[model samples]
Target chain A: MAVYHPDGPLILRLRAGDVDALGELYKRYKTSIYRTALAITRDQGAAEDILQESFLRLFTHAHRIRPDVPLHPWLYRVAVNLSYKWLRKQQKQQKATSDGVLEGLAASFHFLPEQWIERREAQEAIREAITQLPLGHRVVVVLFYLEELSLKEIAEILRIPEGTVKSRLHYARRFLRDTLEGRVPVGEIVYEFT
Target chain B: MSSRDLSSFDPLDRMVKEALQARFAGAEPSPRVWRRIRREAVRQGGRHRSRGIGDWAWFLLMARPTAPLVGRDEFPLGRFGLGMFLFPDAATLMTLRFGW
Candidate 1:
């Protein structure tokens, strides 16, 4: 008996140039991809563009895509590559405007005023720390935490050794721990990986 | 259990996850994204189809050998072939196709 795989049929349909299949895939993964881009770039407009370009590449390269495997990793690989490209160009052009955008992103969460006040400070500090990370470390942080992808999966997506992913994550977490320690009360910062 | 298992109930990981989730909770791309994607896809599809037709048209036009042809060296483009004529420079082609 053939095993059931959700993406197999969608990928086959996509290969046949069915835009609706692309749309279906987009509907399924848009939020995660968008959040990944948003977290990495810290720019809403650039994130949207990355999201659109990622799907468009999926559509255009459907013929080259293998239908046997899950499509999630490929989408992530493309999104991360595009985000890196944007970040490189952006670094050459302007400084990050994450303060206002991060504030807006946090504000969009409909929390009660008191809870918002309490959580907002910590969340903002955490987010700022994340944004301050080097892009390599930031990509790992986003993929690991935001997308909740496993280390093996992240290594595959980033096309890096698992040890490299672990190291980057280690570096990023330490940076965040140090940055957040004095700014916000994050309790105890443990180096579990050690 | 593997030494690489990251599921050891780490508080820092949990806090990072919560902070990320809270920051981007309910965040999504606007509807315009799909619209623009569709438009660009259609445009690219049309461009590919037209380029295919152009290639065939160039072939058919050349197959007859009705027109007098110049030497490959006399016409620098002749070395590159008529395909180069059908498609202009990359910059112009990109501008024409994508308006960028």
Candidate 2:
């Protein structure tokens, strides 16, 4: 039985040289791709660059893409590859930029100043712990938790075996738990996601 | 952290999810990204189209018969006319010479 893929038609249109179809597809997945890049790279400029490059590749390689399959996974794969390249190039400089961004984000007060400060502090710690993780483990953590992708989806996106993904996630979770155990009061840290 | 343990990490999973969401709640790419993509895509499409047209134009020029640059009576290099025999047309001769 054939599954109905919404992006199939968009892919066809794009392959037929319809720029409007590309725009529609971009609008559909831009946020997901952008967020994925941002989470992995931890740099807004690099993330934006990855997002643009990913879609441009899609446009260039439209004819080679299978229209029968969903497109987001391909976009995720491209974004991840681009993020890996960026990480390789900016390895030494990443920590300083990410920490500054985290500090800036923690300083902004959203609601009650007291509660916001404490929660932001905890979040900052968690994020710092995430950034400390090895690159492969960090990618898994971001795709699993931030992107909310399943193990299978992550495996396909990363082009690694499911066992590797599971191992990376396990180690990442343990590291985060160990790093934030005594420092953050996990029970008191309450955050609402909009 | 055992490699075989693949079950959900429970409260830790909850914390990680919430923390990530809270941290990047309003994060978004700037509108300029799409603009730049569209511009580059259009430019690339134009390049491909022009290249295709140029290739077709070259094919037609090479394929179409042309009047000889000089009549057989005026043909020079009598025995060494291999270049003229092979090219036969002024367009092909000029193309080979100037690499247009």
Evaluate model 2: give its lDDT. 0.73
lDDT of each: 0.75, 0.73
Docking class of 2: incorrect
Worst 10-residue stretch by lDDT in candidate 1 chain A? A108-117
Error of 2 at A72 (Å): 0.8
Q: Tens digit of lDDT per residue, candidate 2, span B1-100?
A: 2212323445566667778878765688999998899888888761222222323454543442334764565443441354344435643656689984
Q: State which candidate has the highest DockQ.
A: 1
Model 1: residues with Cα > 4 Å off, grouped in runs: A1-4, A95-117, A189-191, B1-10, B46-100
Per-prediction fnat: 0.42, 0.38
Model 2 agreement with the true structure over A91-120: per-residue lDDT tens digits: 557565674643454344222234423766
